[model samples]
Target: MTTRFLRSSSVLIGLAVCGILPQLHAQSSPPTEWVDPDTGHRVVQLSTEPGSESLYFNLNPFTPDGRKMVITSPDGISLVDLATRSVEKIVSGRPHIIMVGRKTGQIYYVDSKTENGATSRLVCSIDPATKAVREILKLERGQSVSTVNADETLLGGTFTERTDWDTNSYFEGGPNRRTEARTADQQRDSKGQLMVERLDKHYPMGLFFHNIATGETKSVNRGTDWLGHLQFSPTDPDLLMFCHEGPWHKVDRIWTIRSDGSDLKLIHKRTMIMEIAGHEFWSADGKSIWYDLQTPRGEDFWVAGYEVSSGVRTQYHLQRDEWSVHFNVSPGLTFFSGDGGDAKMVARAENGKWLYLFRPELLADRSDGNLDTKGLIRTGVFHAEKLVNMGKHNYALEPNAMFSPDMKWLIFRSNMSGATQAYAVELEKGDAK
Candidate 1:
């Protein structure tokens, strides 16, 4: 499908203009088009694909340490160190669930290996310093641990299976002749349960916690909600957060619980048939959780932050562009990608644009800094556009804005010549002073 963006000057100013005062609407200026200030250009393009071929790039949450990026390679879970920018193969096969510790730089993932010719996926880890991948524990074949703590001490994961039943004999009517409209995975009973022939088996899909320090793994034993997108609390490593995609045919979930499998609390729920803000996250102080939800008509997306104690939810609305604005992926956030809701970096799906930086101070308060949030907002940077409906889209942009450890240089990835590469833009000299 085609995506469109709105770039009216007023809207761009509306989003980018957040400060001490909250304006009711934006005033018109020339459509603030997205241009690299240094080169004076519009549209930072990446990749050499013919015409809008989807290019896949992953953001490494653990890259801050300059050690490794957790990536899925043909040789299994691989760690690419930015210092060397080299991909090191740590294990082989589909290590489906992979996580990297932001503080300790430890990498964890799921590896399915052949033991006596039988295959199973297990929770695994790789130490960047030693370049070693080791198995921690083995669960049922389909179970995979998806998140790990920064210290590599806690792990969370999920497992799923299908329960099927026969339709011909169970029905009140005589044996049915045809089952035309059913795939094995699609057929379900009246109560939303799978129709399986055995009639006695229950598919126990659940979430679990692992004490990496003790090697003692405990099954969470929650209901059949498909649990995933797990992470440990930054402040209290013993706490865990996760999203549950209820039943095989349901939407996403947001939840938080303790590592020892106590106090399972459902944070958010929706009846929609989409991922919702299912790629969920929590705030640094464990006071809130954040997630994304697509608009009801799928016209746009919204980012949400939920206060853990008060259960107050706040939604950040993103202004949409009327012109085709194709978005294939969600902008992956940085340190906040895990349990703590603080997100440092975010990626743009359209044109592979990136806005990477960490501003813990700004997020702590309500002051929206130099970012324009109203127009073409991705990864917290706003884009202002002109022509209410089309050309010269205004963008409240911080082109190539990445922060140093102390929020110094705004490093960004640019492709002026159509080759994706890295570049850094120093904040206006006096801005820091």
Candidate 2:
């Protein structure tokens, strides 16, 4: 089956004619609603704050009922009512956001304070409706919480012990580490170098579980492989998934372990050199782990899935232009969303600057009536549809696109208005000119 899919030239011309060219400046009060000329999708700016942004692609920022979404901005953490699109600042100061409780409908975050050159992080949760706050625990300077379990009984995170290395050394020699002193290109290169250094050093880190009720913390797994991206399964309270953080091509990347720290198993084994897989996320049902897969580092792209129980694999191929920084599935699994990357991205995808909606079509089975060949790995392709033109947006701020709980909109962040802000594109494209 052919893997390449071409976009329309007329749509590109339409976008250019609409003044949606690259590097468009910000407006004091950008339009709240507008129809995307490239795809005719109705795009809505959800936040009024200049630097507002949604949670990371893997994090769940929506409340259990899906009526409210937790967003962060220069002001603080806020809640957006999906029905009315009203924004309310629920938390005042800039606290590091953890994740919303899947069952409790509470917003979890970390409030930090620096005293005598030492920082203390207080883990807390807030009720959006009642505006009540609950303090969970205090973490040491190097300790942090990343995720809450399915039942909201435990918090999962990692702690690093880097006594031998100067923490400031990561950014010390890199053009002064100030935003004003370094261009985005230089910053990107500097970060890449820091990652290489960290990976080569194999810094000591450990995964831990914090009991919210007992206020007890227990170390589960310890390693020097640069442990990061800790996430608990949305369905299973005891199952936790984490990654060996580094350059994607260098590490095994994904692994799963019990909350109590047993059964540490690598999810994907590299079959060939330069084969890389990372940016993994769980399916809505938690039955499969989906991730970006590249064979020989950027030559080909795929969104691959692995069944945890059956050990089966499925891969959906996409064109170079369809490759996204992050991909998310709808609640109903009807379609997938891609926050496309820029030209400077690893994919080097020119004209890849668009928010895309993809319909996955599974390739037909080719068993040839052979029982032995049955149940082989399934392969498929994505039918891409452009939703929002991202040409004017900067790639430095990734558009971590995710589906709304109702699957009606794709929520993402963009700096098309000169400052990072949250935006959503309606899936139905209703009455969009």
Candidate 3:
């Protein structure tokens, strides 16, 4: 790949025409396309809109045809043609995006309207091509729609009882809440205290399903544990996964259940004190569930997998510097990618800020001359490769990286250019260092 550093006057003028230079006037414009000095991989900016961000790591942003991806900005939701690198605004509103329909390629989102201090969420889906929208269901206050099922028939989400302290004020407070600025350590401590208080309260929450065709809603399960991170299996419409959200170490986080409120199974049980697992996601084939696992909070790291059918376990060990806030697998399950974290994160890695590609290599068989003595659990190590040097990126804006449909690029969000924007790094063959 040819490296084009944006230092010349001509390049700046070109970027100005593209509407990217004005946003970078306070800071020097980062190269629109360049080869990383630390890693030979090529990186390109995908969205020209300031404050543009890619979808969450677990959410499927690509359409069913895999030719275009849906991205969000302050203006609205837009589509990026993967082949031509062209962007087109599709939905124009401040709607909260759910996920793209797995079968219909419709963009599903929620639009909120507040009336007389009461809020109602309208669940809707739009045809990306024609911009025609169909209102599916209307959710009452405190109700949310998070995931669309594999067949596009059911919408999975959670409903929570409103409380005076439910505004996530622990993390972000109103202007009048604090009179003085707090240091990073003080802020972390305050947030931790709030989390502990909330967890102890055991707030009431419920998991629900909404049928898109009939407009019927059903509550599947109700509990005090904070229900969150709801996701449906990409291949199995009935299989839904959620987490008991809290400080990771304090909760047995990963759980799966059927759509009809049966077979509620915990995916992982902490084996030791401070051991934690979260950030769970389903494999492309929906045969396995993967998550970031730490042996004992912040000490050891692994990308662990659970086979839903056979109840088997697989883990790939990673170094401290390789730990990421999120990890994702390719469509073909060829490899995995990580958006590396900074020093303030759990791993506290000195040189951890980078985009990484990992190839899992299973451990050699250790059963001495016994072919049938293989252990129930599988172990592996990652052959790590640096794809992009993210030393300048602000971890406050997570990189939420994932593989493109063709597996030729890794998409992520970054604030390296002084504004949060979406970017993609080319996964070039024969370019491994």
RMSD of each: 15.6, 6.9, 5.3
Local lDDT at 378 for model 3: 87
The per-model lDDT (C-alpha) reads: 0.43, 0.82, 0.83
Of the two candidates 2 and 3, the one with more favorable TM-score, higher being better, is 2
How well does candidate 2 score on lDDT at residue 313? 90
For model 2, how does the per-residue alpha-carbon lDDT over 39-60 read when each residue is reduced to its tens digit? 9888888887887888899899
- Per-model clash counts, in order, read 41, 1, 0
Query: Model 2 TM-score?
Result: 0.89
Which candidate gets the maximum TM-score versus the true structure? Answer: 2
Give the per-residue lDDT digits (tens) of candidate 3, residues 135-221: 888887667788999999999988877676544544221110221366434665476676777677776788999888888888977
Q: Model 2 shows how many backbone clashes?
A: 1
Over 4 Å off in model 2, which ranges?
1-28, 114-119, 164-186
Task: Kindly report which residue stretches of model 3 are placed more than 4 angstroms away from their true locations once superposed.
Answer: 1-28, 114-119, 165-194, 369-375, 429-433
283-335 in candidate 1: lDDT tens per residue? Answer: 54556666555544334555556666666665544533211112111223232
TM-score attained by model 1: 0.53
Q: Candidate 3: minimum summed lDDT over ten consecutive residues — where?
A: 171-180
- Model 1 — which ten-residue stretch has the worst lDDT? 336-345
Angstrom error of the Cα, residue 86, model 2: value is 0.6
Cα displacement (angstroms), candidate 1, residue 28, comes to 43
lDDT (C-alpha) at residue 267 in model 2: 93
Q: Which rank order by TM-score, best down to worst?
A: 2, 3, 1
